[model samples]
Target: MSQHQILNPADHAQLRIHTEAGAEFGDNVMASLAMPAEFREVQAHYPIVFRRDAETGKLAALALFGFEAGENLFLNGSTWEARYRPMAHAVQPFLIGRAAEEGAPPQVHVDMGHARVSATGEGMRVFDDTGTATPYLEAVANMLGDLDYSWHESDAFFTALETYELVEPFSLEVTLDNGSVQTLVGFQTIHEERLSALDGDALAALMAEGHLARIYMVLASLAQFGGLVARKNRRIALG
Candidate 1:
């Protein structure tokens, strides 16, 4: 029942950022550039700044570091790409203003794109395809024919969403299961989006009734259960 703490202001400053940690895929670790002081009175939020190889200091991802105008801001590393550069420029001013307030320098920043590095020394790879990326709970529900196994009923599947009151935005798709000949897209929550959706009202309500801890617990549980399994790339040897 522990409460979530907004990362402290000081901790953000001290982190050294890096895109490639080593030869291993997941070995690429990110850290602070040089910890900053607790100067800003406001709760400052800044995009992750990566340390560049050419220079010893931190470098901002190009997708997030400059100004263009009238565009969407790319926040997650997954969404950063050539297609998103224009959007990043649109919000450049706002980002710069925030960065200035935090006394953070800017470098070329970009989104990490939709990819995850395996802990093993494998190369970069996509985590999931559109057909099957739903969270485990939702996947199970869909695979087993709705949360209550009432797929035969008209509204059983849709009712699950209403019942869970999914507070977060998640991707769902219907696809074929290897053993079963059915296609289904199960529900999966987007962590960053869900966190962003928390408003002052929600926060106050959660904290007031000890439900805040429960919410976090549920999220953690979901994360552990909800992961996309990449079946294609996996190699299975049959004797």
Candidate 2:
């Protein structure tokens, strides 16, 4: 039987956001997008939530979906003892600990206090009093669907990707200046592996001899060489 190729958008969405910049996107959104999917399956059960600022009434940040487990309550990492709390806050009670004392809470807050890049080519760095540092700027230029050299014009995008590792099907929901959220999906590939396979001692010499092109080209070439894998229910086959 010939192998059948199946493209599942959900599978690519479930990757972890270990990077500080990525965590700002929120757990609910990431989990919803990242969970692996079977053919003909519906969307994820949980809804991506955005937190509102008490003072401003604006959608300030995202949520990590911390809920009470029982007599013993559980947040993301820290554990809390359950108590008789008000009905309104019973589901996600506020913990009284170092994180709460610092007013950071269990959720990853984004906006003025986190990494931000301006459309006008300006950048800023933000730090919380609790020693959390965020570098604000367009660190990378990510092109989805197909690889193109035209994106190399942007300084921040170019500089960031120059030495960065490529992770496939990168999903991100960016909050725009007007408080609108935009979702981006993309892929990544690295040059280190390809360069290491070559017989070279000098790193500079490798680049001078067109190593970058070879790396990126190899990634695309995988499609031609049947490196792409097709998956269906109970089966994974080469495409």
Candidate 3:
């Protein structure tokens, strides 16, 4: 259960958030929601794919960390192996909340029940003694802002892909050195053939909206699959 509360210095003065990456802090996940704004950095570390919401039928991008659920290949001990973690994953235990009034600005809300919510005073303070937001809190706020904006804007990006039929079902079967096999399905990726076949006008529209570059980033990120498999193989060998 989540205990989300509006973050305020008065109410959360002594709250300290555990900043390390580990399963206890809910870091052991196969994937995270990816935003197009961060695709350039994400592409260098994780494979980007798309998944559709069963209820809304809306497409959302994901940055793959492993082939199976609860298996984060990039997680080693208490550290995240990747140099760049997707903002959605980085901004954990805190989320953007809106006010009851219409058009009110977003508020920072913290999950008091999260493991990262340090109960024994073992992590970074959210606010200083003077009730001022600490540098850590400031950074989290920025990440939340970026994530909120990018997530909403992602709808247009996905819509453009859908309109052009540029997405296709994707699946992968990995064979580890130990003869263990893993299969991944129910994902989608950019359809290179359809994208290439788009006429000049379609290309110009996508380029004008800056979706073309992001599309290419998703394509480029597929290369990281090999590295992901290598990480899995290493883990198996170690065991």
Candidate 4:
């Protein structure tokens, strides 16, 4: 469970954010819900796929990092292997929170129990001694704000995919070095066949909505699965 508290310099003047790679943050499975907005950045390194939320059963986009649950193959010591980290995962321990005043506006909140929080001098400072936000803190605020806005756009993007019936189940079968076969399920991907068959008007509409490129990006990201499988194999070899 998360203990989210509305971030305030008064209550968190001494808070410090972790500056090292996010690999130590104990987040193996990262949800890639920032499609359309973050598709290009995420696609450059991670395999963009789709999954449904266990609690809400809501379909969402995701960037795969491991073959199994609770495993992050990109975790190379304290640093993640990817050149570009998903914005959804890059900003850790902070999230959009409901404002204390009713209907005022959403505010940024920090997880009190997050391992990244510390009172020490190392890492980025959340606030100055006089209880003012530092540059790093300001950047985090901007990121959170941007994410809040982009998430709405991403929602519409996914809705368009659903409307066009482009969502389809995807399965991957990989053979490990020891000749053991593994089947991955419970995931989905964009239907390229349907996309390729769309009429010019529909394709133009998708282009107008800025979703066509992202849909193609999602399709292209599947190629990274070969890398993911190799990574999983490397981990197994290490063991």
Identify the leading candidate in terms of TM-score: 3
Superposed by TM-score, candidate 3 places the C-alpha of residue 2 at a distance from the truth, in angstroms, of 0.7
What does the lDDT read for residue 178 in candidate 3?
Answer: 92
Greater-lDDT candidate between 2 and 4: 4
The list of candidate 1 runs beyond 4 A from truth reads 1-169, 172-184, 188-194, 225-239
**Over 4 Å off, model 2:** 1-128, 131-216, 223-227, 232-239
lDDT of 2 by residue, 121-143 (tens): 33232332343433311121111
Candidate 4 per-residue C-alpha lDDT over 97-189 given as tens digits, one digit per residue, 9 for 90 to 100: 875687888888999787777656667888898888899989988988888888777887888888898989889898988788877898999
Model 3, span 69-99: residue lDDT tens: 9999999989999899999889989999999
For candidate 1, the TM-score is 0.21
Worst 10 residues of 4 by lDDT: 26-35
Candidate 4 stretches greater than 4 Å from native: 30-32, 54-57, 100-103, 119-121
Cα RMSD of all models vs. native, in order, equals 22.4, 22.4, 0.7, 1.9
* TM-score for all models, in order of appearance: 0.21, 0.17, 0.98, 0.92
Clashes per candidate (backbone, < 3 Å): 34, 7, 0, 0
In model 4, what is the error at residue 143, expressed in angstroms? 1.0
The CA-based lDDT of model 4 is what? 0.81
Model 3, TM vs. native:
0.98
Clashes of 1: 34
